[model samples]
Target: MQPPLPGPAMILHRRVVLSAALAAPPLAAPTLAQAPAPTEAPRTLPARLLPVPRSVSAELQHRIAAPYPANWDHIPPDTAGWRALQAASAAEVDPLLPGLIEALRITVTPTTIAGVPAFDIAPRDMRPDRQGRLLVHLHGGGYVLYPGRAGAGEAMLMAGFAGFRCLSVDYRMPPDHPFPAALDDAIAAWRAVTAQHDPRRLGLFGSSAGGGLLLATLLRARAEGLPPPAAIAPGTPWCDLAGEGDSVNANAYVDNVLVSRTGWLGAAAALYAAGRDLRDPLLSPVNGDLSGFPPAILTSGTRDLLLSDTVRAHRRLRRAGVVADLQVLEGQSHAQFLDPTVPEAREAFNEIGDFLARYLGT
Candidate 1:
C-alpha cells in the first residue's frame, strides 16, 4: 500500500522530532526516545478566523478536529490518491463500489455529454423517485487531483435533489493540462448542453476550488458572449488565487488540514494560469465584473476555511445586481457536501436542487 500523505498531526510530529534533535544538549543523556523540541504550541486560537462569522455547532467542531471521519475517505490528492480518485470517477471507487452502491440502491451511468470529447459520469435512471434536478459539477483540487472522481454516491444524490441534469465536467487537470484547457472544456460542455437544451434550463455548480472556477467560467462566458446559464450554486469557492483574501492567512491554523493556504495553491494557480496574473479578473472571478452574471445560490459551512471567500463573493454579486442566495450551514467544512452519506451533505445537496428548481424552472 502507498504511504498516506501525512496529515497535520504527523507533519507536526515530524517537525517536532527534527527541531528537538537540533536543540539537543551536547552532554545530555538521551536515548532515541528522548526527542528534541521546538517553540511552545500557541496557547490560543490565531487572530484571523476570529473576525469571520462562524456557525459551526460545538459538536461538529469537535468532530472536525478529530481524525478524518470514519465515513469520509479523505485521502490527499497527492500522487496515488489522485490516481485512485481518477479511476473511481472513471469506473467507481473500489471494484466493489458497484455492489455497495447497489446495496444503497443508487443508479449510475457512464455516459458522454454533448460538447467535450472526454469522459464524465451520470446517475439518475435507476432511482426513479430520486429524480428532480440536473447539476453540472466541477471537482476542485487546485487542478492537480488525480482520478478526480466526484464520488458516485454524492453525484446521484445531487442530481436527484438538484432537480435537473447534473453534468459533472471532468475537465483536464494541471501539471499536465493547464488553464485554458479546463476552462475550454467547461465552456464546450456548457455549449453542448445549451445547443439542445435551453440556457435557462441549466444550473452550474461546484465546491471549494471548483466553486471559484464556476464563477470564473461564467465571467469568461459573458466576456466571450456565450449564453448565460439559468443559475449557479457554488459552495465554499476558492476564488482568490492571489491569496489576497484575509481568510487565507486568518483561517490558517483554525482551518487545519489545508496548511499554508497561500503556498501550494498559489503555485497551482500560476501553473494553471499559464503565466497569467494571479489576480487577473479572468482568473480570479472574485475580482471580475459580475454585474450581469446569472442569479446564484452559494453555500458555505461555518467551520470551512473559505467561509470568507464565499460570503465576500456573494456580497459582490449583490452589489452587481445579480440575485444571490447565500446559505451558511451550521457546522461543515470545504468538502462536506461531497460526503452525501452524512446528514449535512444530504441537506446541502437538497438545498442545491431547491435553488435550481426555483430559478431554472422559473
Candidate 2:
C-alpha cells in the first residue's frame, strides 16, 4: 500500500524538528574501538530504480556526490567554527583575485562610499555610455561570513561580464556588529555613489543575503525619500528570513548548497536579526511593500531552496504594477549562476546586462 500523505501541521512540525536538529551541535565521531564491524555486502539497486534525476548536469552531479559538512547549522555565529568557514572562503577567493581582475578586464580601487568601506570595480576601458551608469553590489554570506575581499567575487563577475561599473560593499557583520550594520553600510554606499552619479542611471543587484539586503536598502531609501535606482536585480534572494516559504520545506536537502532552511543560513539569519521579528519588511523583503518600486529582474534555479522566495518576490512586484522578469534555470542549485564555467551562468548575466542596459539608459 502507498504511504499516507502527511498533514500540513505535521509537515511543518517535522520541518521545525529538522531545523532544530540541524542547529544543534553534531555528535562526536565514532572511534575505531566503537566502530561497527564489517557486514555482508548487500545487493545493489538497479540504475533505473534509483530516484536521482538524470537531467542534472555532470558538473552538478559530481558536486552532489562530493562530501560536505552536514552539521553546518550547528556552527555558532561569530565563533571559531564560523571563522574557520570564513578563512576557508578567503583561501579560495584570495587566489582568484588577480585572475578575476585580468579576465574581467576590470580594475579594483580601494575607496570609501558614503563613509562605508567599498571597492570600485571599473572596466579598464570605460564605455562613454556607461560613464554615468553605476551598479551597487552587496556581497552575500548570509550576513555572517565572506567579509573583506572574499565578498567581492559577485561584484567582479558583474563588472566583468555585464560591462558595468560596479561598487562592491564590504558590509559589516557579526562578532563586531549585527543587524542594521549591513543595512547602514548599504544605504551609506548608495548615498555616496548617488552623490556623484545620476540616480536615474544607477542600478542594484546581489545574490542570496545580498539580494535580500538590496530590497531592504531600497525600502529604506523609499522611506528616507531617496530616489530609487533605475532598476534592481535580487538574485535568488533570501526573501523570507522567517523561513515561511515553500521551497524552504520542499527543496530542503535537494538544494545542494543550502540543504535546509534550518541550516547555517537560517542560523545566520537568526544571528543577523538579533531579536527582531523575521517577517519585518526590512528583515524579510518579501513582506515589504513593492508599490512604486523600481523595475526588477530576479533569478533562481529549479533546485534552489529560496526558489519560492524568488517566485514570490517576482509575483509581488508584478502585482504591485512594477515591471518584473523571472528567470528560472534548469537543473541548478542556489546561486550556481556565479559559476564561471557554466554557459547558463553566462547567459543569465548577459540577460541581466541586457535588462540593465535597457532600463539604465545603456
Best by lDDT: 2
Model 2 per-residue lDDT tens digits across residues 167-215: 8999888646778999999998887778787888999999999999999
Q: Point out the worst 10-residue segment of candidate 2 by lDDT.
A: 27-36
Model 1 weakest lDDT span, ten residues long: 68-77
TM-score of 2: 0.82
Best TM-score goes to which candidate?
A: 2
Q: Tens-digit lDDT track for model 1 on 1-362?
A: 12257566767777756666666656275444554353454346634433333344444555465553232324435555545544544454446556644544445555556544432334435344324434577767666553334333344456545434456776776656678787887887777777766677667887776788888888878877788878888878888777777666655545543545544555566767878788877577889888998889888766566777888899999999999999887656655656544566667777777777677743
Q: Which residue pairs collide in model 2, if any? A: none
Q: On a 0 to 100 scale, what is the lDDT of residue 123 in model 2?
A: 86
